[model samples]
Target: MSANDLPSLLSVALLARVGPARERLREALGQAGATLVLEEDPNTLELQVLRDAAPGAVLIALEPAIEDALERLDPVLGSPSLTLIFDEAELAARREGWEAQRWARHLVAKLHGHLDVLPPGSEQDGLLQPEPGLPTTPAQLHADAPLDFHVREAFDAAGDVPADGLYQAPDTLSEPMSLEEALAALQPPFSTPAAPSGPPPVPVSAPQTEPPRVPLGDHSSWSLVDDDAVAAVAPPPSATPSAAPPPSDFDIARLSLVDLEAERPADGAAAGAVLVLAGIGGPDALRRLLATLPAGLATPVLVHMRLDGGRYGNLVKQMARVSALPVLLAEAAEPVQAGNAYILPDDVGLAVRDRGLYFSADAQGVQVGTLPPSESAVVLLSGADAGQVDAVLALAGEGAWVAGQVGEGCYDPTAANAVVAAGMHAGEPPQLAQHIVERWGVSE
Candidate 1:
């Protein structure tokens, strides 16, 4: 062991089966800034032994055999004073060299206190390459972006407001004047001419002149010009256009895919699955959820994330990189399937058929009726539309495992908040994923 393996400030209790795993974990705990107070197989460890040790933290080397070991050590495991750390024995046994050192550093950080555990300076994926040049700001750009035109125009269109500010009481305020006196101060059209305050003179009216009767002469006013020099650029009268060949007899779909029954949504009925809805800031939540989902998930995870410019294809590729299951674009008229994730586009809509759901173009948004209320689940993630909150709650009322992403890392929590307000489960992406797996009883 290196010098870093010296006893740490914190004391830790290790619970693992008596074997190479226990031996390795014993060494690892020492290297990970922890002093071992007790090391025993959880299956046989006495409750008194844990109480006597009373370590500040507990390290559990997890494996299939120790699935119920925590139950045996429930008293220690449930202690509020002790921090519990679990790591896969298989994965821990494989760690060596740099991997072992990195794990130790992370363990130390966790044992002590830190915000985020990460590489020293940057992401492990790759180094940050600085750009050679930065984008030039347009010279004509306004200091402040223009506001709504209606708001700007509303202030001055009627000329009600002055340049300086709102009008104030005039210093020379006058008493109320008579109606006629008020009218007399205005202009001729504005005022009523004061009704001519004298004897009525002979009513003089302007003469109505009859329109002149001018006889129309065809081509007389029109100029008759001699033909100027012209070149022969007209199409030849002898030229005849050739006819197009008839559509090939081999044509089967009648020149339109609509004629094919196989292409319609009803032909491929929906196979009910889990529906996950999100918008902005959803991709990261999706990554965590998909990453934690256990293998061999029977139901399909349909991700409906509305993106600008209909970038579903790009989304599918990005998700496929992180997702354990194959990511596919939800095509129109295709039935929802199992064992894979489908990225639903804006145009693709849902329809229920025989208690199942399928994608179609006739509608938009989640069709609550199409979803098997009892069988289907709805997970509202970050940036999900709040409009669907009622629908998800309705499903929840009908026995669906409706959930919302917790406030953490959620950019727009309107929808999730609504679901949570309605008393649905709210959790982080991984926690939600675990609930879903457990609900389906398909997780290992």
Candidate 2:
């Protein structure tokens, strides 16, 4: 489709298994003539998105597989509309963290380019550059050209060497000669060529001996005896002070990305995908958590959850029914299909590597201390033409889609707060509703 056509084409990458719903989605795409690309592997989805072409695309993750695609395709692809689909009854089921991480990486890859990283040499002021027509070659510049040269010249003028001496040149013999000839030439002609000029008439033999002694007058002797003599004496040792302590770690994080927008949606298409994460829950919770979102969110819902219990994904699916947005679960390492929810597996986590969601062998954990499961957030830019697009979603007022269970206990409310703080420290404002709830002490 043309670039313009693609934006309005209702493009979506469907990630779902073959089944009645899958077939139905395919039929719907066919009927609507939407540019729907069905991917069984998220890796393929990531790979298929070329940087320049992804701006108008949409991503529908019907299963966990979409994470793999996001990871693989992040580097070159842009963030697209994302949706997740799954059964509504499994609210308590554990979801995998890796899956959420993959999705986050996808978002990161898609939006990271938007970060306001200063170009080289821009951080500080007062850095000077050579004026126009100034010598570009180092050889032409003098070591002390601007300040010391003139001062040194003036000092030389006051010394015994006359200024005129600067203009004189040393004499040199032009012709080559054998040692004997050179010696003959130098011999008496060198007979000490006439003694050089310029010295005064002091006799060389005169000795520097003392003159006849005359005792000093009593006045000189009296001055010496009455003086208060001041002699130099070694001073006592002074006390040494202890060193000061180093700055706190918070000081470092403050210099980092605290409270910054890490990324933003590149276009309307991306805005649509961002809608999934606008509330404390997923597509299902849209109605209760928020009021009136833009039309982009209501059109199609994309789910990308990184919970250890599959139940949350199921709950989200149930809640999606209450809103106008469609919702479901995505599969692991599968291509995302349009108009469906994709759920991640609860056993192992997922990540976006290359261009798709790949299942990680590692188990999920929780958010603790200052570190959170930022890996998922870090990797999502895999195929993305943009970087940090996920950060932009919140800027557009849509919350982010996250599957917390990556570290020690990501689901704990305290852990959520830590993640939010970490994101804030990283300069990306926390865009997840759950993170906000934790920060504000809100509960369902």
Candidate 3:
């Protein structure tokens, strides 16, 4: 089946273990546009009911305790047409903030077989599109044009003067007051009559003489002096002379050129390893790819899949069930070995050191561009994030063997499609597996 052939509405049978996890999964499936045809507990699920309901897909929230129940439902599991999806129970229980957003995206990708799941009213057609012509320039102000009515009225009012020429009145005013009349109204009336003023007194005669200066020698007690007293005092010296500590032998060797050369990885050896990046519909794709890999493959496999904090344990167990090689969660400071598949944790970064992989506590996590391109094989699987496309392309340009999952199986091919468009290898999960097997020359 091709991606174009995917059903618009999926009738899903949910055989999930009951808890907050099951409810969270149900909500996510609803958001992804999946119609729940039947919901039943994994413990009590019967093959007859599954046949009767006839759902297109069966979503199972795998828990460690439900292995016995799954074994009994082998008949339903064996159906070729049914798409079996296994999710870690604890991971599905996370339904808050960014975790909820990621869970919804993954759920939609798994059920709808595509990454472009938008909310009801968020369709591109509903958005306002820009007008086809150039934007209309704002109407320019004309300097030669007449002033606005209010501005002209303000200028005319200021210029209008009364007949006295001492006061200006607004054109709207009926009467204007004179400056003399306004001042006379503000002054108080003289109540008592003033006595007859005597004749003005004669101007006083003036005699001026210059004052004399005193000699500096007359004040003998006060003298000007420089601050030479402070310079006379000296700071105290140390009680004993101390010698510097002798340089250590260890420090001398560390600075030598031999030490720097020893740190680098050997030339002509495989500096690169296999890196697998996936998201939403990656679990099944990963399982299919891992199953075809030989037991003693030379290239070390590193997998980075988006999952909740506590889901790594369950994922390792689930992948081991179908993978031909051992699947294990990668640990910090551990060396990457051949034939074993390592699942990368979300909180750490993976790096190559001494020809082996090592993990660091980097919040940004493992970046694809940080790996050595000449020695690495990168597989872009289903549901890979679109944000990592550029980094993956850079790796391809640096001579890394890059492959992407294509066709119906890749529900979220956003990152994979980017790699394919850049002229890298493109194929389904099984074909990707075959490519890796042949590239590394595994004795399969």
Candidate 4:
């Protein structure tokens, strides 16, 4: 069926070895916006029963226990209208909380053909990303007109300052002081004010030295309700008045390459490999992505996602089931092949040579800095470390095609979001695969 003809709420058939995994799969599918047509244990289910239900998709929680039963339903697996998705039963049974919710969002996105799962950040992800016409730089935050208007408004309103700015006249002042004396007593100490009135006036007899301090937060006042810590929260004003400093302490200029080192690509280095870095919600993403890749991609796919359990052998097997390319666990001192997938751990890394790169156990992880940027590519997926963001961006600056995962399924997109924020490309796994094919062109 054409993509446009796909259903809004896909009818799904659930098959598993009748246990907690089946129930978890049922709930997860429902949460992902799927309508369950049939839920049955694959070991006891009949093929004709599944065919008669006519589900748009079939979700199989695979395990060795149900292997023979699944083989009996091979005919149904080949149906054009049916989309078969296999997930690990152990993973499903254990999935819970936010991780399960993230998986559900990605599943719905896959079924519905949309990527709207937002990153777990403030609701204001787009706040700093203003359109072209809007203010982008710090100096533009206050421009000449707005600053003049605000300063003049404050100065003009300062004349009508009320008696005893924040502190009221003490009920039992031992000295029974005058109104001016009481006001003076509360002046400097009670610098910040509250109430629905203009702020207490500072005597402008001498020229005001320090530039005006901004309000504590987004509120339109110089006061903060935090009584316990009286320390200043706002940054002190800069000496230069010609150009306005950043509105907040964080300057966007920090991301610029002004302070970074200048490293050129090696003179005669050849194209190395396609490197993928993922975490948290990455296994599913990697599985889906690897399944679409052609066998003769002619570039080693070096996957460097860390699994806490160090199940690299299991990862290799999982990827091999879906991948057209030969997926293998990186071995010590082995020559990196042209069209194979390597699941490299932190201890293993590439050993650069005159011919090409090789997997070396002696090396300390895959170092992107050692690769020729012009001939390399880096893709950051969910849960990728933000610490490598600077190095990746530097490579992008040197002509490497860099991309980040955008949309649902990527649970921790901290590194991915950082890449996208810096104007790098962002898309779903399949979209990125297509780009890879288009950019590098494929073989037989």
Q: In the order shown, what is each candidate's alpha-carbon RMSD?
A: 24.1, 27.2, 21.3, 21.9
Write down the lDDT that model 1 would get.
Answer: 0.72
Q: Lowest-lDDT window of 10 residues in candidate 4? A: 261-270
Please provide, for model 4 over 166-220, each residue's C-alpha lDDT reduced to its tens digit, 9 standing for 90 to 100: 5565554558578788767665554556575777777879677887996544333
lDDT agreement with native, every candidate: 0.72, 0.36, 0.75, 0.76
* Higher-lDDT candidate of 2 and 4: 4
Q: Pick the candidate with the highest TM-score.
A: 4
How does residue 288 of candidate 3 score in lDDT? 79
lDDT tens digits, residue span 192-256, model 2: 46775887687888987878996543332232332334223322335233455666655554465
Q: Tell me the tens digit of each residue's lDDT in model 1 across 82-131.
A: 77666657656766767666667667876876534555675354466777
State TM-scores per candidate: 0.41, 0.22, 0.46, 0.49
> For model 3, which pairs clash?
272-375
RMSD of 1: 24.1
lDDT of 3 by residue, 135-170 (tens): 655454454566698797888897574477555544
Model 3 residue 272 lDDT? 58
TM-score of 1: 0.41
Show model 1 residue runs off by greater than 4 Å: 1-271
Winner of 1 and 2 under lDDT = 1
